[model samples]
Target: MEVVVNRQDRRKRRLVRLFLRLLLISLVFAAACAVGLLSYTKMQGPPPLNVTQTTVYYGADQSIIGEHHQGENRHWLPISSIDTEVIEATLAVEDRKFYSHFGFDPTRIGAAVLANLKTGSKSQGASTITQQYARNLYLSHDKTWKRKWNELLYSLRLEMNYDKDQILEGYLNTVYYGHGAYGIEAAAQHYFGKTAEQLNLAEASMLAGIPKGPSYYSPLFDLERAKKRQGVVLQSMVATGYLNQIEADEAHLEELTFVQNELDQPSTIGPYFQDTVEKELIQTIGIDQALFEAGGLKIYTTLDPQMQKEAEKWVASEMPDSELQTALVAIDPRTGDVKALVGGKDYTESPYNRATEAKRQPGSSFKPFLYYAALENGYTAATTLLSEETTFTIDEGRGSWSPSNFNDNYADDFITLLQATAFSDNIYAVKTHLLLGTDKLVEVAERVGVESKLKNHPSLALGTSGVSPFEMARAYSAFANGGKRVEPRLIRKIVDSEGEVLFEAEPEMTQVLDPKLAFIMTDLMTGMFDPYLNAHTSVTGGSVSHLVSRPIAGKSGSTSSDSWMVGFTPQLVTSVWVGYDKGNLQKPAEGQIAKRIWAQFTEGALKGQLKKEFPVPAGVVGVKMNPENGLLATEDCPTHRVSYFVEGTEPTKPCPPPAADGQPETEVIDEATKEKENLINRLFRWLGN
Candidate 1:
């Protein structure tokens, strides 16, 4: 019996020795791992604390214009900026041993581990403020072992690198409160309509209790529950020696005025413009969407607040309150910076940004592109095409397309290019389009910053291609800027939260057009406002000409469903479009509204600005010519006007001496001659096809 008992004791002692040896090995392995992790973390330096802060957008003058966040309205505040009561309450509830412990409280952790084991779940948490902040910054709040292990390493690294105050401040700044509020500063503002520094003891305690379960403890979510949480916080503060019993009781009894209605959010000056900036940052500028939303970027945009207000104001007042939607965009001709933009009459009802998204046929507004091509292809402002009813041959003469002038009106005679453009003579424009191959116009459109896809259709000259107002403005900016490529830019610079410049815009320009040809086209566009250029039809811009107090060059275009007015000066380019959504037919009465809005906005936006003229480039000469014929003006001509021309393109001959009769001689076309001319035009059309 004694020998059997000795054997049992010996077996028990051996089992105990084996357990001790294994435990010692495990301790050594864990210590080595901890030391290696610490060394690695130390070499890595401090972890970034700028997690998920609110991105602020500023206008040209550096005034706040907009803000964005990743569903959490986080705003960072220093520990000094935070209220004393808030810190005390947070420390009392979150980590009483915060200053004394390294990064975690082992006593509380041991107790929590036992409790979690008993519950068979991670229902009990003992994270100190430092550990919580580390998790908030780097790891997700999953109760899994992997996340917890990562949290432990991160927390240790933080404690080694930063002081206690830094961890506390970072925690206060990044901890999430409810209702889209992420930090204590945002929380104080959200709940009390005051800043974190202005928080009273009552408000501080209320805010400090929110991090436990933001949705459940938010006063906005439930006042009674929040008050109970606040009471617990006050009692904890008292127990932690941060508050006396009397003070705690007084704070608990104090009546707090929660913000009734959300503090009137400062209205963003231009919502559509803001959206475009965000888009350019992500899509065109190649910024990651996650970083753009959560990186706390300081976006400095080119928007002029006053100009934006005027744009919205004029659009609202001038636009008739109907289902007809409108889009307006204004840009600086020189810098290519978008100054103001309105996507639609109401953004809430529809977030579709028509300024940048809607692709409507620009109608006659597209003629400028064709005209520019003509100038490039040996056609001058003095060039003439017979404006008569004509049918054009297409596809090797397999089909015919007949184009008519507005109101079926026609000069039925030779008219100068200036007159053709001023009158918007469709017959003349079509003849010119076919004369210059369709590819020329498409090439010109692309070079001048029209990004929309253009097809080589004969009707493209009459503005059959769909383009957005934003593209139209950019295209016209080249003309206004003397032939330099103008890429629309909304954000001038972007900075990260740490004051590092993420991106900065440099004024880049490529000479895309002959400076002389661009200047001449700009000069020709002004003919739309000149009554002297009127022949069969009124000048396209004549209705709004009287509204111009300065030398403003502009054009108006209309399709069955869309209306557009694009205009510019040396300083600014503005484009306005009015139309029904989804291409519904627009009423004739609404046609003039686009012009009115353009004129009013242009005049308003440039009201106090200097009147600048388009600088005529070298190698161009001005000559007085007969408005009726593209000939040097003589004493017999009824009207004379100065026309700018490339030095050699001016007509060498004066108008033919007046006939024996006092009136000028008119070309008399006999029937045979007319038929022969018609056959010749058809032959050219066939050849072009």
Candidate 2:
């Protein structure tokens, strides 16, 4: 009886312990359920509050061009705005069980786990479309259990709060489709130059497959891989009953044709321009936290589609096969608007945008401002200066620095100020800088849009100072716009998604130089290209004559390794630079590419515009001068020989007759001499007066 009682007591104790353990387990599970429910309730409280101001772009005519978002890194359209077929196709291929799942599909998850186990590796995702949306909207793509749990929980909450259409809309807007594209709208426009509403089934399936891994399936990168993925998506659609087998097969077999409109196509647009605008946009509009998290943005840019296309073609064709790169920046001088910009040969290969980012020595391009400074300081075009070889020693406390012209020759023999400038005589420019004072020249450069740090050294006259193409273009606009400096602008105006103006570029034009001085500088630059004035003309007569209708002025520049040409017509100012990425010296073959590109682009860009010569200001006047000597000339002087002068600064005395010896010689009276002498005296007096 005692033994039986002990056995029963032990059994009762064991049963009691087991019951306690079961109760504890139940309580823990209930607590977990309560916590999950609380989390779900928090997530379902509201769609993340976001304020995305769509950027509104305007055409040159001020017409509405396009719109972009801040969050999605691309343009976004409402789910209702897209075609129902597009939505169906996306769901059919990406997540057929999308509408029926609670964010996570148990059956798919089991199958994925089994596949992983069998393959001894993970190869599939169990998250439904709603789960992807949730991950995009709220959770990160971290491959951690914690992130996965959060994704699953938020996805379920999303499904509960939103209908299938709403979930689909959010997913479409938030998914990344590579190439810096965020959502379907951007992807559609980026790849096919169309909207989601216009995509055919084949295109739709191709785009849908991209979300799985954009880089891996990018048609631009690998068409074959993209086609294979697209085929899989088509098969999935058929299997999911979204398409009949025959229809699916036909769609798969159809040629994948992507039409890229100049404006919407990513290939045609300037990648560097896009990068620049994006940087500027980031500063203008703060990235909205919600939209950024959600991932689609409609970015309306200031790029002119036609101009960009032309520029891209010019670079690809004109740029040499060498590693040397080229950059171009074109702007409307009147408004300081950037009309077109090409950063490099290929953005994928190199993201460095030489247009605004790279700082290269401007070479002789810096001479213009020095000349302008000379004009401002009361130096006239006929101002005589010795271009003979000379040297200067810098009183650096420890050592002396001497500068020499590229030609290693001096104008000491006698070269007119105009001739010295025309030839880009390095010695003459340095001497001019010394006479005018380095500080004053630096000040003028700063006023005319040189933002780079300039030293007070004489070498600065030779463009030893580093500067960007954008700055150089802006500076040249002072000459283009008649002395007014227009700050370079990338964005014309910014509007929200609702078409409300968030910001607009109010161009600030400041008179950086006297109109008279600007005209004199332009005149001097024009003479620089005249073969009659410059012994070594950098441009041909055909090129110079082309600028005659419009008062065009330009300066060609060459540094040790970089070549530059900054010039302007009455309407536009363009700057082009060519150099190696490593700042190495360009071979002769590579250097000429920049000049060729500039000539080609300018010819095409000015096709329809009327030839308008640069407007000559009232104080400016032209006078005939001896080509060899910048002095008042007689009828005997070359008719093509001319120099610019401020009315008061014209030559007051006639050039003396050429001397045969150290002493001045008298003219021999002959029939030819008598007639020519009288004509020469009268012409000189008229020019002097």
Question: Using TM-score as the measure, which candidate wins?
Answer: 1
Superposed model 2: Cα runs more than 4 Å off = 1-44, 47-75, 84-165, 171-193, 199-268, 282-295, 305-325, 343-346, 393-412, 494-502, 534-551, 580-593, 638-642, 652-689
Tell how far residue 442 is off in model 1, in angstroms: 2.0
lDDT of 2 by residue, 198-255 (tens): 8888888889899889889988888899999988888878877778888888888888
C-alpha lDDT of residue 650 in model 1: 68
Score candidate 1 by TM-score against the native. Answer: 0.75
Candidate 1, number of clashes: 0
Q: Name the regions of candidate 1 deviating beyond 4 angstroms.
A: 1-50, 77-98, 101-161, 176-179, 184-267, 632-638, 651-662, 667-689
Alpha-carbon local distance difference test for all models: 0.85, 0.72
Q: Alpha carbon lDDT of residue 153, candidate 1?
A: 77
